[model samples]
Target: MPLTILQKAKKLFDQKKYSQVISLLEPNILQYRESFQFYLYLGLSCLHTGDAGGASSYFQRARQIKMRDPDLLTAQAALFLRRGETDQAVEYYLDALEYDPDHALAKKALQFIRKKGDKETFLNMAETGKITAFYPKPRRTSLHPAAVAAPLAVFILCASIFGIKAVSLSVGQETRADLSSISLQAIDLKNSVEAGGSYRYILTEKQVVQAFENSQRYFQSYRDNQAQVEINRILNSNASIAVRTKARLLMEYLSEPGFDTLKDNFSYATVIQDAYLYQDCWIRWKGMAANVSAPDDRFGFNFLVGYDTRSALEGIVPVSFDKPVFLDPSRPFELLAKIRIENGSLSLLGGGIYQSVSP
Candidate 1:
């Protein structure tokens, strides 16, 4: 009878009858507790049926056994994002991208984030009249008086038109890049956040797990690309593929949540706290010397979280000072965490409700 039920459920799941599959599997997942496949399929079914919380719980159990499957992580990420946990969604996208760059869903999501960010920036600039500040200046001197007058005027007009277009294009490109980078970095901050015990958000635990999984994928890809680059150098071969691959990997990581660069003795620590929620933090030492002209970075420092405000840390090593910042709990949503990187060290510090405190 159990086998018959599973067979029928599988048939329904294959037929895109997610609701039917969930109806059959949900009870079994709760009863059997031993069938990982049941949980996995149940999660998928719930996901397709638009049950975010249910899908997350089922996926968490499935993830315990199939930890390396990016598909599971990606599915969970989608649930988090759908639930408005943007930070977690960004993290899973990164993890999925790292493992499989050809993942169309993740690529599309990243593109969406970049486009949205650009639109917002453009709107802000328009609202603030920042775009109107740069006024055109006429040419000061022209070669030859009469002969240059007509031609010079024409040339100047053409140059003005070209310059304006170029400037607009440049700004658009830069804005899009910045938005993508910022979003990815924010997710990183979310993951680095230490869960103050309970998950506060709708899909907090699922998002956190996804973030960690994504970080693992990113680091692995980063190291692999680095290795390939080194091999190319040693072989004196064309390093284009290796360089491109590495750059692409970096871009994907930046698109995900919680991407950071930190300074240190030998090198900067490039850390990822968690890829999905962007909370778990890591640091790579960046061997940048202290600004000798300004007071040494030995005592006071400036700390920044993602692309947000820079808070001044007094009489202490700001890079090392990481604490959870609570978000307002009155609303239906919750903030996941805050990621801060200062000095030459990178770390993912925790804050927010959508987090996990290990048992």
Candidate 2:
């Protein structure tokens, strides 16, 4: 009788023979086309063995089957961050947040990434229309021997060309109209306010200018750090080569930062609180901070000052402060908050500290 592969693999695994188990499972993982668990286990095995690249590949395979797992998403983001691919890390972090807005790890990862350096590369691409541009493809040109040999074929070919040309003209007109309509809709939507009143639909041109200004400051700081490192070489014999190398690597990485997708960031925020439920009652409410960043989209209530958590730390709630909403990419947004109970009676949470963005 043949010994079972799974039994042998298990025996190897139980004996702390990870290499043997991996060898046994590797064949099966390749042979079985539909086994997501195999890939998940393979990823774990690789991770245990310190093969980051192999682990990432296996985890990516697992992700194809379980696309929306926040835990896996966070793990992938961590891996990307370790590999010095912060842009990729931020992408996965955003993906993880999309699934679980309250995901603390993902939230922290995003905050950490944002603080590293401004993502100027991504923003510049957006500003230059590179990200959204559709390049014009040239039409193929050819002369067929059949066109000269057959009159009927030539007539048919000419008719087909005219038909295609007519269809192309019609499609071109429709496409232009569609593009124009979409552009107008985008402008309108950008001008609208979110349900949470926490964010405006469109970043004003002024906001874009401010973003560029901040990015320039970040770039200047990055370059200054580089210059200081170069100048210190003469007197810095005590500095380890590895430390200097690592610093140089970091500076290079920060030189070209990426940008968040402005379109995706403008979506309506989830509803966190219902005003009618706590009408005229001073109540302490708790929620995930990411959801509270822009609350105007979900409700029409005005922020009266004592409702904002502007001064609160990331991943922590400030039940005491009542401030208005503010959008700052350099900071972690306390998306979740609630009105505080003060004195005996309920008052409309009012504090002029926070102002809702314009629609």
Candidate 3:
């Protein structure tokens, strides 16, 4: 007898094997189309695997099957939050709260997004335990008697000779110089900040790079809010245009509905590796068309596409169009298509194809 879908999924989920869960459910989704549990499992699995669109679709299906399920509502809210849809997430979280007021995860997540105050709190939350844990505590050491006595004697001598106003002016000038030095240091450090009672530190370039890398990882892992914070850091920092452009593109991909999900300019490797995760996602790719086939009676036109003219027939993506179009195998072409994976190979399902303006 075949193992029940939920039972098998629960076992995989317990093992933290989310991809296996997705593989198990996807092929059987049509068979258990009406099962709320099936959709819920599939949605959670997709969310874990960083397939936000897939998770959203499955969650919506589950919600349609059973709207009042608090878990489903919370999961949907999380998906919305990960996609940077804060208002939608807030509404869904509120709906979930209405169903289950004491939902701890929803309450915590809501508080996390809503609370706004203090650089320390923001940094602490953004870096989690990493920053605070690495920060050394102030050492409890006593000042020497000679050090105290020397300062006290100097203060008395200066007060007797210069009077109060002269001493005050001298101290003020020194204080101004100290402040100026700090201001200069802040600028020189690029990404340094004063935190907690005169303590100052600069984040090294490596740290900044690591932070951005973490943000990308979080985004791919369906941790959108965390990813957004890091992306915003890159956007607001003195980072190079290349880094900022990548962050902006990622933000647009997550936040803009008009943007196509399949076509990511930053990470082509990710798209290739996780093609199945983005099945049905639309992309606009510019390449050279080759091996063009005549329009079939039923299926339409087909061709193989390569990234450039030199490799026009090598490592090509199989593409299909609904109608016959003019093709120039030598010149570059552009395609706007929905992606599909068939029998472990990538293909374009259907969309427009045209000649490219650039070579």
Candidate 4:
């Protein structure tokens, strides 16, 4: 029944109550640390209040979190304009157009800049109310000046870094055989906009950054298991697909530790305490097989860990194997199996076994 901070902020911003917007959002910065919209709103308010330093700081923070936002770009352009940085303003507007060609503020700004971007003329225009036309309203999310970049533009952007074989051709001998021709290859520019405007807003951009950094640190420490947990956190999070894919790829060089070489060889008791922690970890457990069912290649049994010593039974864990092994219920064996936490139950997936009894 209550409006959230963002909803209240949006209402205040739309009403042109820029000071109130700043007042409402500044204190709650911690709550919305990862929120791009929050920073964007704050930046817009700061710019309007004539605090260029504050606006620049908020805008820079917003850009670090999400660079492709058109509204943020347009506001940044406005900030550059107020700071008397026409060149930078033009660049920001152009950058905004690249992401959103139909951006109204960017288009108007670019057009106005082209006509009156000169120092004295721009200053004269600023004296009048005409310059206000280029400023963007936070509520109005719209884009239209330059068309979306075609495959040709794509080739141009990539020309300096490396030659895209499919999109490049050598020109007539002009010293270094200047790459002149851009391939006519069609590149479908991805206009990715989420259909539903509502979002759950799970992990903040800051959290994602911290998690990724922690994972890299863990990886550098050679604690691949801990590193893997952090990596999986990012992979399984509600972060962007590109970010998740990047997280998945960051540990491509990670080497899985063997059961024998594992730094933390968790005991049955330790595993029993927290199965999820030891998940996927392989441990050599000593036990005897019970209810042995070996049919051809598949083997299934209940491993009675620590039952070898008739003094006490640690736990009975269900185990299964795809390899053929003539297991005897009467004889004791040491099982090296990977821990699996399935449906809140702990189980062992058999990898190998050392038999005390003859095979």
Candidate 5:
């Protein structure tokens, strides 16, 4: 059944349709969230498509589901290798070998590391996302493919050959069924945070408690953007590690709101009054673009908030967009952005943008 859930993604992966595999699998994540194969392939697709952040996130999610997976270790090693981190790649490959001593890919990768000197050999392996890239693939017998085409046919053949109980036992052993429940368990941080390390108490105990309570309250009301405001405060504050630790965990459950869903949003005018209270909150505001610059993939500009009226420029805040947006220096624009507290002032990371006619 687990294999059945990931069969479509596997087919797409085998066909080397990496981007299409991502498109097909990402949307239906809820259906197969428990399947290790699903996230591994999704992460690989992201890796191949040059989305390192997405790939890293998916791979971490996969690790939470199954820690001792050899293919996942190999893929992570490939990711590190692609980034030219041979030492990290070696560590991951070694970890894979510890799990599967005779694992072909890990063994072969180690051998290449011993005898070979060229970084390109490892780089190519990373580029192809395979330790076996330098080697030729084995040919399978043509007629052997027809023994089982459908899932039912495969199941029947296996059942007839090894009895129904044997089939179940094989599946159970292959997937480490005993550890499946423990796989997704959260990391116990009680001891780590209780010590509180070397942090100074920036906010008073009462203030810290207030922030936490407010965050929890907003979380219950499904106002995630508002909830994050408090979380950011805790993170940026001199709160003890234990309280900040809980704040970080609570943060994991907060989801970003969309345009229609974001409500009761405070504007830049309101945010400037108490920026600390609105840390990491989203705001919708419009202004003129001044001194636009495109360095690398991001667009940066000084946003003239509320300057569309031309009567008064409420404030000038720096903003950058990760997504491609139309940028004209002489234009007024509406920016729906997440506010970041930078250098005791506000900046924005663009979530969405709307362009108006150039003035």
Candidate 6:
């Protein structure tokens, strides 16, 4: 019997005949439309032939068919790294780890790159020197007199200030009491702001300004959860509209991809807390579709989402899709979406929803 197209492709692929694999697979892709393995093999074949675009399309189709496939994620990450897209490569690698933390290849690749540092550093080292058994001696340099004196001056200044402040505080009971009162007041003000209190009524202008400054410091340090809490407090407090708007914008900026180091996959609560921050950023969220709306004239759809099927629809989030989405209320779904916050309401703008496989 003559070998089938898929069998021939597989045989050629295993024999390292990548071009032959492509020739066999390309024309027969439609015939194997439901075969993820076919697309995956074709993608790998294209990758070996240096046809990155073709490989990417094939890989993407495979991903759409099975989004959580760790092998596919790792393959895509490798492709991204080859293309010099380090950030995207890292993202995909991290995502693969999310699915399978023990994935040895992804783990090893991430470790190697992280230790090697950036590509430029690696290239520079490679171009500047050749490997040899014998190596040249290093040049030595002496520290400048100014560099030595600078640290001495700073040390003396800091010591003097510390001594003066310590003496002033030790001088009187009244001064100690006053300082304690002030410290307590400052703590109270901070707690009030973090708890979503109206700082205008309880704190002076200087205290309010200090609280805002402290919150900004938290934001800069990647403490986004704390920053969002403070921002929420400011929004609900009796702050000026200008201050509130600035707070909203700051919250939105902090929710961007590179801002938070701790979270790769943001929760729905995270999105709801600062929807504006996640705007234009991709998110992976899971929820059950409660009420799926018909597609509008623009082919957009809206749906109310519950965290799970058994949950009540009230207080549920409204998710808008710029394109129609096929939803089944019985099955829980996950979506990789771009967030949109309009008129203080959060919605998903446009992205495909992935239905969970039936158990």
User: Each model's TM-score?
Assistant: 0.34, 0.28, 0.34, 0.41, 0.44, 0.43
Give per-candidate clash totals.
Answer: 44, 30, 0, 4, 0, 1
Q: What lDDT score is found at residue 217 in candidate 2?
A: 41
TM-score of 2: 0.28
Error of 5 at 33 (Å): 39
Residues 1-359, candidate 4: write the lDDT tens digits: 99999889989988889999999999997788777788888887877776656776677567556666778888877765764678767656656756665567776776666666776665555566455566677644423233335234433433332332432232311012211221011221121112333433345666666666676665555565666656566555555555555556665645544344445456899878756655665678887888988776577899999987766799999999864543457888778777787898999898666554243
- Model 2, range 244-300, lDDT digits (tens) per residue? 233333333332111210111110111123222222222222222222343422221
What is the lDDT, from 0 to 100, of the residue 85 in candidate 6? 56
Please give, for residues 129-149, the per-residue lDDT of candidate 3 as tens digits: 222221111112211121212
lDDT of 4: 0.64
For residue 333, what is the lDDT in candidate 5? Answer: 67
Runs of candidate 6 with Cα error greater than 4 angstroms are: 97-102, 121-278, 281-336, 339-359
Residue 6 error for model 5, in Å?
36
- Cα RMSD (angstroms) for every candidate in the order listed: 24.2, 25.7, 23.7, 25.3, 15.4, 16.2
Q: Model 6: per-residue lDDT, tens digit, 133-220?
A: 0111111221111121223333333334323131232221101111121222444344433334444344444555555665576555
Weakest 10 consecutive residues of candidate 6 by summed lDDT? 130-139
Better of 4 and 6 by TM-score: 6
Better candidate number, 3 or 5, judged by TM-score:
5
lDDT of 6: 0.54
Which structure among the candidates has the greatest TM-score?
5
Residue pairs with backbone atoms closer than 3 Å in model 6 (clashes): 252-277
lDDT of 2 at 282: 24
For candidate 1, what is the lDDT? 0.40
lDDT, model 3: 0.53
